[model samples]
Target: MRRSFKISFLLIVMMICVLSGKCRAGDRFIRNSAFKGDRQIIVTFAGPVSDVWANDISNFTVNEKPDPDIMLEIEDSTLSLDKTSLVFTFKDPLNREVPHCLTLKQIIADGRSQGTATVTLRKNYLAHLFSVFLGAVLIQNFVFVKYLGLCVFLGVSQKKSTAVGMGITFTIVIVFASMLSWFLYRFVLKPYHLDFLQVIVFIGLVSLTVQGIDTVLRKVNPALFKSFGVYLVLVISSCIILAVPLMLAANDYDMFESLMLSLGAGVGFLLALFLMASVRERLELANVPTPFRGMPIAFIITGLFALSFMGFSGMSLF
Candidate 1:
């Protein structure tokens, strides 16, 4: 009993450390604030050994003298594995409280040739919100550009009733997934330097959470579940349930940005799915060649729908 108690105590302490930020996965122990200067750069490695080849990297002004107003520091740890590559980035760290067009890229390798690239920080709140609205609606539309969740898009879209049901379902799942992912990331994986574990962790947690929610709903509200239970299985298969949360976590978005993203993504997914279903319902009677009967023609129509959504670009709605 004493041995077991000791082990349990150690585990609890480790969990506390991971949440408290004593350790971290990415480089830059400090979260870079939007300071008056050019930019801030940070790089991390897989293992304790220094492996970043920061030479020849362009697009930033280099200083030959002492460290400029901005500087980078490298640390080595012997506890990490050397195989897999991991990258953790926030698209809008400067204006994380708002929204913006953010990009994060990380490449991991064995040799000393591993690095990450992140750009597009929101300068202020107004610009970030505008960009977020516009980007969600049209530019980085969840359906057209990313081709995220399409199974339900073409499945439950036959009737207006079913479409509404599926839309509500999608929104709830996305919101829950996004919130859960952010919690796991901010509170669990990130501090322990286990960011590479995101995919498996997210999949397992989302599957379990959705299943638990489904069970609870079935027990508490049988009628609603009966009406939408058919869609639960479909929702589990839809990648958007997993993708939206992972995207928000990876981007390090604030609560508002994450919520906006989830809502916008849900809308985009619903729009595409409903529109496709409606058009296909009408196209059933249209004349088509034998080679393009069911799926072939559906694909053709989907391509057109994607093309049409592109016209909403350059419009700021946020």
Candidate 2:
């Protein structure tokens, strides 16, 4: 009993460290702007900034149009020492209907000159949503692009019907799990600085959710449960299942963006599974070489799929 307790305690500590480590943000520029018929735009950076960098109108440019109806004149520029943000108030209020572009020639931060920070000011929320969806599905696909959740992708993709079932299950679970994890991290863990416990908390939430799903399936349709019971159980430990929430936490995506990302990832996983299953199903009839018969052929096909997905690299919605 004492040994078991010690093992459990070590596991808990490890989980805490993992979760806390996951919450640490990386070096990246976070941009935010506000327009309420006001000419002021605030651009914030979550990273560090050097105090020696000049904060002046000469350092920034607005509206790249050669000949413009409305010219953007920077009245004043202010830099936050603690927050590492730059705020600019324009002489004229920006046109909300038309998109505006701004460029910072040199943003020296952390003793390093960030050569250029280009920002496009567009309040098109729908476009942003579509971009997020497209990115998640194609560019950053969980399986092909990100190489996540391969175990389930390869294991249950032998048949199209089974692949579709697993895809649906994954979609439902991932979407719900991401949203739940985001709420927990944002409200409960982050506020209290208990983010170190995120790994354990997220895994616990996912396991409970998968269990709930299994219970429901077993009760409502025993035949279906018998068919895909093992796959459903395996989802609790699926890397993709955990990855979605971890990414959401790391990127600090809002609720809507997180939901879209989860949905896109699920759809992308489903698409890959379906394609692989169809290809594998056809391969069974083909008289292939003995060396490249089963798993070998599957891996080759997956590599081809990954290559195909590479076409979406650097694709931008805007």
Candidate 3:
């Protein structure tokens, strides 16, 4: 009877200690951690850590998330003034496009040795892709921003009917040309070391895309084909069309990035045509002075448009 009573008392004592947070010797943990930039990581602990353990580079591990194979070499580590955070500097910049993991092992905080804890610094692929698309469309527009495709912007924008037709036709041609150029550059030319042939090859691809589009339109809609007679050929020489493929190759953009940029450029060009056409149509009905009439007024308006687009140069949607 005494033995049973003693065992029950000991069990009650243990439960009380556990419930009061006295059973565990170490409960200090990580509050959160994040990357400050491409070359630094900052970790904040739930409680103050001992400088000896927190500043020791050997007690921490930093690497790309979900893949321990790529380890980052720490150039140096510093504990915060309050000892609640540790900042780790890397020897080189991390891939800003990838998430990284930081492991805090042998943590000594709150006068006790705590277990290992890990924090993941996340990467948002969707946000990055969105920023790229927005950059091409508004921040780096091919027509107003880079001054390319002005020939088409001014030529077709005289009439709303022709401007709409040209915009649609240009979009289809450029998207197709850019995609095909990427495939050839990645698979064919890159393998054979035919780098020098890029300019000639890209031009040929543009010509081919234009030809295919020409045939389809001629068959399905003869009136539309006649309306686009010379302008369709002019698209073959437009700077924006050729520049996109060359930029994709130079930047080594992946398939999705290439597609987004190409599409964004097309939409941006369409926007320019539409805006210019609308204003030009209004100008046709308005009374105007003779000297500042046709092309002079057009150039002035384009200049104002360029200045307006400059405001979006550093804008980020993500």
Best by lDDT: 3
Q: Which ten residues in a row have the lowest lDDT in candidate 3?
A: 18-27
Find the 10 residues in a row with the least total lDDT in model 1. Answer: 71-80
Backbone collisions counted per model: 2, 1, 0
lDDT of each: 0.60, 0.78, 0.81
Q: Write the per-residue lDDT of candidate 2 for residues 1-318, one digit (tens) a residue.
A: 896899688657645754674342222464565443467777778676664564657877778333345457888877776756767888876655345677777778777877777666655767777888888888988889899888788898999998988888888888878877987897789989998898999999998878887897899899978876767776775698899899988877767778899999889888989999999999989998999988888998999999999999977755
Candidate 3 clashing pairs, residues 3+ apart or interchain: none
In terms of lDDT, which candidate is stronger, 1 or 2? 2
Clash-forming residue pairs, model 1: 48-76, 48-77
lDDT of 2 at 229: 75
The alpha-carbon lDDT assigned to residue 81 of candidate 3 equals 93
What's the C-alpha lDDT at position 179 in model 1? Answer: 64
| lDDT (tens digit, per residue) of candidate 3 on 181-229 | 9878977888899988999999999999899888878998999788775
Give the residue spans of candidate 2 off by over 4 A.
Answer: 1-123, 220-230
How does candidate 3 score on lDDT? Answer: 0.81
TM-score of 2: 0.63
